[model samples]
Target: MFRTPLAAALLFATPAAAQQLTPAEITRVDAIVADALASTQVPSASIAIVRDGRIVYARAYGDQGPGMKATSADAKYQIASISKQFTAAALLLLEDEGKLSLDDKVSKWVPDITGADRITVRQLLSHTAGIQDYWPQDYDFAAMEKPVTPQQILDRWAKKPLDFEPGTAWQYSNTGYVVAGMIIEKASGMKLLDYLQKKILKPLGMQAMDQDYAVGPGFPQGTHRFALGPVRPAKPAAHGWLWAAGELAMSAGDLAKWDIARIDRKILSPEDWAAQETEVKLADGSGTRYGLGVSLGQHDGTPMVEHGGEAVGFLSENVVLPEKRFAVVALVNADFGGAPGEITQGITEIFYPPMTTQPAQTIDQARDALARKLFDQLRSGTLDRALLTEDANYYFTPQASADYRDSLAPLGEPVRFAALGKPRLRGGFVNRNYEIVYQGKRLVAITYAEPGAAGKFEQFLVQPR
Candidate 1:
């Protein structure tokens, strides 16, 4: 929960402009995904780019898994949290039909819920209900393995006190969506998945959006490389528990189709569509970066509506530049190290390159390499004088090195290192920051370096974030 902020910051960097992609720029989108697959060693991925309510680019690359050949353009991959957008849409549609109202008290439908009388349907949609997240990453796995029904989920979670008073703060809560899913069933008299198929999926001709693995042709296999390692084959989302929270699987192409139709307002009225895109306000009327199920923000000066998802063995991202009528949807089969947003940003840069270019690629490479080397030495309780200037080396002397060792000893071993953002030339030196997570500690390694033959560490600091 805490770690995602860094990645989100990197993905939403402001660009100078936004425009339509030319034919050559569209080709570069494919190249970006291809390079990502080759460099990261990701098994397979499906990518689709849409423009002006049309599918401009949709292709799959690499193998589906160990034995399968390259994935097909239509091969389904779990869309993860992107499913939330549709769930939110369905609820809004119900409101349009006079079946329910966003201002209606949730207790009206689920009376026994602890704070249902105080929370509104709009609060749940916007994650301001203060409901605790149901499947926190650290939750016990044994409980998740056992199937659960919506009523069982409500009985288990709805009676607890909210994390805070409704509309007071914003915290992403999968449980809120799970509760929303139940409300859809109670108000509409249809299963959440079946209602979506009849109301949204079939209407859009999105055949690839399967509710669960047991039905349809099933999802392409996915593998997790960290923690749990290789998981069992991917399947449809279970009926209960994760149902409305995150349980839809579809191809990148199909996901793109949904986004295209959304821009065209094909399923819902214009007012309802606008509500889905509007950011929710807290008790003080401060805007949350999130709106309903989708996030609302600007990328490179261009307003954007987007969402990303990560499940057992899949990672997906969907970005829509509504003003430009451009969207990019990427679905990957591997977990742990995939960068769907980075791939999406690379595509965005092609269509809307940054206004001012920065340092040469070589400078960034040098900074990253030197930063890694310094941190490696620091973790080992030593400092490499050769990598620093005489004045810089004096700052991290032997005594200081010993102190660093003593202070950081309890943090345990370093487990992961990742760039926080691109290296940039600032004050005549290249500045960069990297996230280094220890077994129990997380820190940002801030570094400054001078490039060329005399390039060496000008400044270095590593401490708790």
Candidate 2:
């Protein structure tokens, strides 16, 4: 299931009219990847950047193994959980074809699953099905060495006691996705990979992406290193063990093609894309900051849609700036550290510098003070309605207030509370993020205020760090 990185120099394949990165910028990128490789002892990495729906940069760094040739641009790595997005897309595609409904109960397709009648396909895609995760460890365990069918996995994990009531909370569960994959096969009457190829991959021209189990031989190998020890070939999970959850592998460039398609909204309808990007709300209306398959958040004030992947001997990060029509894909052949994510951060900063914020004006300072006061009020299960907009008032329902109080009160008083980064301007509101540190835990508070001399809070959200 692994392949050695090929020998190749830095590769650049961009349209003539595409935005060009300066030589210095390219040097910075190279330094970033090289530093990550040296620091983490990761064998190699493949990176690709897309701007305006065209690949602006593609390069590889390090070697195939200890003293082997340099890594090539086209070398594929197991993308791991990044494959979840593909699974989600397959289900969406079925819905588009009127073959299945995301709202359909799991019992409709696979009734043998525990609580199938109570869980919906949409909940599975969003990781809110209350299904216990079958594989939660970062490193492979002995159980992973034994091959098991998806149905067997479900029988072992999905049939267990519910982690919580469905839709009450958000927990990352690979078990939910496995069940989803099974549903796809039942609804489409095709293998999971075949359905993906016919409906998603082939249409997007992502020829380089495929399930790791199906890749057969002649591919490069991925390595694992312990401490500062020598690199050794990593042992992958048995075939079918990672089905529908972390089974896919691909070159960074091919992954970038998928990102471009997302940027251009080429595959799914606009409504479907919106559903995929919207943060899921729990029963109490608290946000999970996770969409169907991707995590939703802001990167230095710009909206970002992204996901990270980890499999034995490989790590990957994929990021998309939908508003800016930009994307970055980083794949590494070593899984011990976060080289791919670090490389992604460095590369993203080169193109989108962090926003600068002036010192808070008088009104802004008042809002900051108010944010602190509101945090305390939330801990006490109380709020000052006169200081909030009508919508905000409605948002703080009795149940929501209690939920906030129960969750925040247990954390006790914060050791530190301060503004984070700079204020963001959007939709005529001044939004700011605040960092709160408890005895041993940290949380972030997102605040939105109406712009005026006497501004009122429009939205205030608290999320765990």
Candidate 3:
């Protein structure tokens, strides 16, 4: 019933500060991947787990052949929808330059766009715009012998009716991001790739990444060569056809660096970064809970901003947990499997294994190796328990810049618990708490948190009655 989907490495979102992981600790995730590959049907996959800023685990199995050996973490991948973040980022950067606003009309850039003027940039970024996806409704899935020019693509859907009235609801429209890419091209007077490289890639030190699809004609996105992998056995894919949506190729090494950026607030400014975290309101006039290019969610109850991708013969993902200071990049050479998400989810499970009485440091160590020594001291019963004594009055997490605990109950607390001087039952992880307890040899924990209205729950460990 459970299907689907962070760590030490980078995020374009900015790298966060935390601890690192040792190679032995990193391999724990690797031990389980044989099963992940068999179940997901992925030919070959590479996964990286970064805790704080260091990559704790990375490995590859299977063939991602590009006239060579099996694909490894260093292989280049066409990360499908994940490219939307890049398209979205270019727009945000332009907005920062005052090139346009999220509320700006598309007609401002795509003259003669018919109803383009009716759509706002905000709608485009979040796929709330009413635009029809450009890939023909009966699009030739197997091949596009002829490349569709930007104008040609817009034309196919020119007379096509929108899925709905602008901003009337929420729909996953690739056309929205396609339009966004076009606007970036129109407004910047540069090819999608050139502009991205100059503005985003080069600045972010993404030297190994490129926006080319080996298929399709028209537009020379780039020629930066890297290893490519085959899906099954025949016909290799060119990167051009992916166009603006998912054409970029990068090594896991470089991708790791970018994930770090997401945590560190390096490439984008603090305000712009914060803007990326704002959730988009759904068509129902309720929030759909996604940030600009980021999706606001969680990995083991920690705040995560991430996105997934699947296009043609490969799948890719980038998941980052800001509060936890880690990110993950999982890429697979498979067109139809769910390896990316599965691989990521497995890695998360290992890194932040469900809380047990095994000791709090075990969880902390899963996230940051740098914390292991300190936690060891605590575990060895060597460190003065006095630290917890003096700090008992304060919540363990470093004081938030603002109160994240406002009026909320804590998680895992009621074997019988209290909060803010009130007798309360914390229903979920939204603000749950956990107190270490010894429960016989099993040492299992009782949980109070669930993913909730706010999308995150505070994991709590409460003392049993």
lDDT tens digits, residue span 1-465, model 1: 011222322332222113345768756765687666544445667788888777777766655653333346777777777899889999999999999998999999877777999999999889888776655441123355567876787777666777788998887777888889989999999988889999998888887544346233334566543221122344323445467887688878788878888778778888988999988889898888889899998877788999988776677999998788888888877553445876887887777776754443332555566687787677667677888754457557565566566655556667877777666443234567777787655666666666563588766666443
- Give candidate 2's error at residue 360 in angstroms: 20
Off by over 4 Å in 2: 1-19, 66-70, 214-217, 356-465
Which portions of model 1 show Cα errors greater than 4 Å?
A: 1-23, 66-70, 138-140, 209-211, 214-218, 227-239, 356-434, 437-465
Please give the CA lDDT of all the candidate structures: 0.70, 0.76, 0.53
Who wins the lDDT comparison?
Answer: 2
**TM-score for each model:** 0.71, 0.72, 0.65
Per-residue lDDT value at 57 in model 2 = 85
Query: lDDT tens string, model 3, 34-130?
Result: 5555544345566667777666555555544443232345556666677777778888888888878878988887755546868888887876676
Give the Cα RMSD of candidate 3: 18.4
Count of clashing pairs, candidate 2: 6
Worst 10 residues of 3 by lDDT: 220-229
The deviation in Å at residue 259 for candidate 2 is 0.6
